[model samples]
Target: MTASTKPYLLRALYEWCLDNNQTPHIVVWVNEHTRVPAQYVRDNEIVLNIGQTASHNLSIDDEWVHFSARFSGVAHDIWIPVGHVISIFGRESGEGMGFEVEPYQPENTDTQADKPQAAADKPAEAAKPKKGLKLVK
Candidate 1:
């Protein structure tokens, strides 16, 4: 993926998984990437540290997410628990085609993905936002 499209890739992935009824895994497809500061990462995954992701279009569930991110220290993937997610933001540019995996509600299995459902499917829309990976292909 291109540099301009790296950020939003995660959000697209999350949406993709939701559309396909699958789960999105957080991963860094690029060799060089920045890591979200440790202090930013939290226990309940308050934020989806943009640095946590390596490529665009990658994503993960909002429920206590945990990932093995590369950050920038080494050439390998390191463990980044849900607590590590310091921020949750959207992709700034790209084809707008990425995806992420979030907690599925049995009640909203029939409804649409983007449409906010009743209390059953999505209890509170303001509860917490999930993280996404910005990478495709």
Candidate 2:
């Protein structure tokens, strides 16, 4: 089995943003398992700036991207599964790559994983936007 290219692309894009003197931002899909500042999420998605000035201890790995940052004077620990990342781009020009969002599957869960109909019904619900933060395209 080969490693997924998503993580590698994420790292490369982040570095490209830095090298170009642009702020790097990531758009993520928030779900029950995603650990993020809820107040900052809207439409089940959030755009985050991961520039050097915005985050600390930033790490982008095969499974997860973790970092610490302050929001409204309060520090927050952001943990996002790579599967939930929609895109990574520059805040200046919005130039970056978008990744396909893979359906989150728990390793040992037995909840509708085998049911295609149940899975098909989820998209409508997922399309509904929650109110709060604004999504950047």
Best by lDDT: 2
Q: Model 1, 1-137: lDDT tens per residue? A: 43333234445555654465443334322111123344434442323333324433233433223233344553322223222233333333222232332323333323335433221232232122333433121
lDDT of each: 0.33, 0.78
TM-score for predicted model 1 compared with the true structure: 0.23
Candidate 2, residue 26: Cα displacement in angstroms equals 0.3
Residue-level lDDT of model 2, residues 1-137, one tens digit each, is 99999999999999999999999999999896467888999999999999999999898877778888999999877777788999999999989999999755555324334423322233332312344533232
**Residue-level lDDT for 15 in candidate 2:** 99
The 10-residue segment with the lowest total lDDT in model 2: 119-128
TM-score, one value per model: 0.23, 0.77
**Model 2 scores what on Cα lDDT?**
0.78
